[model samples]
Target: MAVTKAKKAPTEGAPVFFIMLRNMLIGLVSTVATTLMGAAAKGDWLIMLIYLRGKDGPDKALPSFLAPSTNGTAEHSVVDEFLEGYGMKHLHLFILMGVAGSFIIYYPVGGFWHWYYYVKRRDQAHEWKCQPNKFLTKENEAHAVMMGSFNMMLGGTLSGTIACYIVNGGYSRLYFSIWDYNIAYTVLSTMFVFMLNEFTVYWSHRIMHMPVLYKKIHKWHHRYIQPTAFTASAMHPFEFLLVQCLMAAPIFIFPLYAGSYVGVLLWTYYYGMKDHSGIIGESQWPWQQDVMFHDDHHLYFHVNFGMNTKFIDMMYGTVRKKDREYSEDIFYGFGREKTETKAQ
Candidate 1:
């Protein structure tokens, strides 16, 4: 026959590969749409409210060193030019991401817990409260929220500034592409960062409890002896800045995937509020300490300095011994003495 027979109509819908590809694309699009909607709902789109470019024109009054430049100048390197031209354009958004994004996360989370446990279910949660007899007064609660907000804003701005500086300066080993190394290495690096952070946090916190640092810097936070969720960030601005520095230090010290870095931050934020909430709860993992561990720190200062893990406290004997009174000298192996305060 001159012409080939017409191809038989396919009974099955499509090839399995094509079907799978279509499903994957649909899932991806749905995920993106969902994320965008969530961001919009959370007011992350506030990032779009400000820009370096003004309605009149680019702000030219800024000093040459500070101003964004598309062309390299004789005094500045190509790196500087690229940073100025590209990174500087997003400085406002970076700052907002730190300030607004932190508040967006912190307020909602802390507020919800505060409302549920402190206000709405006070009677129900009273038994589970680590300090059942103790609670921040309403005035004190307001003050705590105010101070926390102030410190968070200042700390967030400082964080944003440092982030802009380091990222634009190319000082950190933070990478976006997971394949730059491998998934295993990325995970290993994240674990390493968390462990290192725990070490630094435990040591720094213990140091802050030292006589001089405690009176001058750390006492501000301890004022909330029975801290609420809102009390999490209620610290001196200096202490807040120091924490930001600790947070930023790790990226410089290791090759951190951006996703891992963000995840660490989110966990830190949530746990910080949770632990300060005065709610008694079991540890999520065997390695992690319960919120009561920190509640005890606030209840009885100078012990339980470990943040996320009990390993350091166990090793250093900083763990609260119910049968003994902990003294500052415990750090030197000489302070704990027998006491009659029954374990809660």
Candidate 2:
């Protein structure tokens, strides 16, 4: 059901600080639960595959859970059994796991966010939607979901390949021990990558908005005028590749603790889903991001080009203007009015 509301000044009630904290906790809990579920499911799938493979063998002997080496004299753990059974190297297994885990984490978390904000609390959250009067048609939602799934699979594989290449070529400054430098340095490095991600997203996204590029590439994503969590990835393949590159770029550029590097990537992803989500409220905490910022970009087009942070847009004078009417020309850019009207 679509949550519709009349045009009026947004009534502020609950403190945005409390709201931000609550949303953060919900997102974190959802991610942890989904991650555990994905891990367990993956383990079971491996076990099943190993068992079935043994069943198809000449002797039909069940594979041992503890030691399932093909040679009778050799000893190996279940992990080794699966790796041996599939004839996969450790690096190959890592890439497969990375791709599968990305898909598992993305859809489930995005679905939960949609259900929570758009279904479970639609009326309660009506005032918070960036465009309360606007809604995506059922067909649009379905298209977004299908395209998002495809993009995730493609993007995940590309990211895994990039990660493997970086590791294999010894190009990345990734360190395993947190104390390789010091705890303070680890924290500082994470912050550095985090900001670098923001910078890259801002510039890359802004550049994509150029008339020629937007029409050819970025326009696929902007088709969803009223975006949901799923719409976060309903972008062109080239754009998806760019996103993968953006996530991997920081690792090659500077020193980063392994654990914190993963954390930074998660931070960027969590915020990406939230930003595209139509759920909207002004950010109260200095570090908290508001959905309205990016949602407005989809709605107003050619403005509010920054993600996760509004400071970049503010610095560059691209933020949507409050004094202007909501239209393509609300904030000026070359060929702003010439941009196609949003898809219905």
Candidate 3:
């Protein structure tokens, strides 16, 4: 007798790989363009000219304090002056790096885990089919990339420039070192920022979901019901600005000392990226689980609306209940029970 062969199950790994690769490419291109634009706006040409001229003209000359400060009248030392100048020249570069870094660190580790454990597994088992309506086409994917990239550049530039100015203007000590700063106070301040911004986001997001606004603004985002990383930042300009403002307002209103402020900004960006990721799983460590709560909401929208915690969603009963009944109805017609009894 001939032996029978078993067919292999189709794998979901390829689709996931392509999705991540495409999004990462888009992000890289966007970051490069934004960095170039930022560099041009910050008088980098002038800095280059000064470096080339070698003390021949006023524009070419370095500041006196940077030149050893013979009088030493509390002016910046040579090291300090160099650091100050370098910081100014490359501020935008650092901002771009910071944003990119967040994505890099979050995806391969946190995102991979979530995709493997939840999304990919579901896809393979055919238990979680992406609604046809939710699939992103090539055109929509391009739109999402453009929208998300532009918004990120705008937000990053605005916040980075403002923070740089604050730090350079005699507040350098505040933002220089996390260890030297009041850690407890910084943590508290950071948490406060998260809470305030969450409320702002909730209301703003809700408003955008309304019919009139949804068609004009929020629909672009909802277009990606099965969102990729690029989908995180994709939004209408107005909506993008609104969210950025909500994230920025607390920083401006209740300013942290410089070092603490830097910490807060970094933490905020990391959280923003994490919240948008599609992955959902806890790490070996307990605290790690808290990271994916917001992202979970975005993946399954009826629940997990709160940014920092599930408090609001739970209290309001917005938590998503698994629709076992709906699934059964889909598999077996709604009146199956009555029909089955009559047949019997």
TM-scores of all predicted structures: 0.70, 0.69, 0.51
- Number of the predicted model whose lDDT against the real structure is largest: 1
**RMSD (Å) per prediction:** 13.6, 10.6, 13.1
**Residue 77 Cα positional deviation in candidate 3, in Å, after optimal superposition:** 22
lDDT of 2 by residue, 1-344 (tens): 99897665443466888878888997678656544333222121222222233223312222243223456433334544554454432334434645576566566666676787788777776567888777888899999988876776675456544443443333567666676798888888888888888888888998888778888898899889999877877888889877766777766777877677666655555566667778775675586558788887898788877777888777887777665445543334322322243432
Residue lDDT tens for model 3, 259-281: 34434444444444444544333
What does candidate 1's lDDT look like per residue over 1-344, in tens digits? 59887776653557889878888997676334333322222232222221121211222322244554656356545544554686453355456666776677566655655776788878776677998877888888888878877876776566555555444544567676788899999999889888888899888898898878888898898888898767777888788777767877877777887678765654554456557779887887888889999998887788888878888989988788776666433343224556432342
**Candidate 3: which pairs clash?**
174-258, 174-259, 175-258, 175-259
After superposition, which runs of candidate 1 have C-alpha atoms over 4 Å from their true positions? 1-87, 163-169, 326-335, 339-344
**What TM-score does candidate 1 get on C-alpha atoms?**
0.70
Model 3, residue 238: C-alpha shift (Å): 1.5
RMSD of 2: 10.6
TM-score comparison, 1 vs 2, better candidate: 1
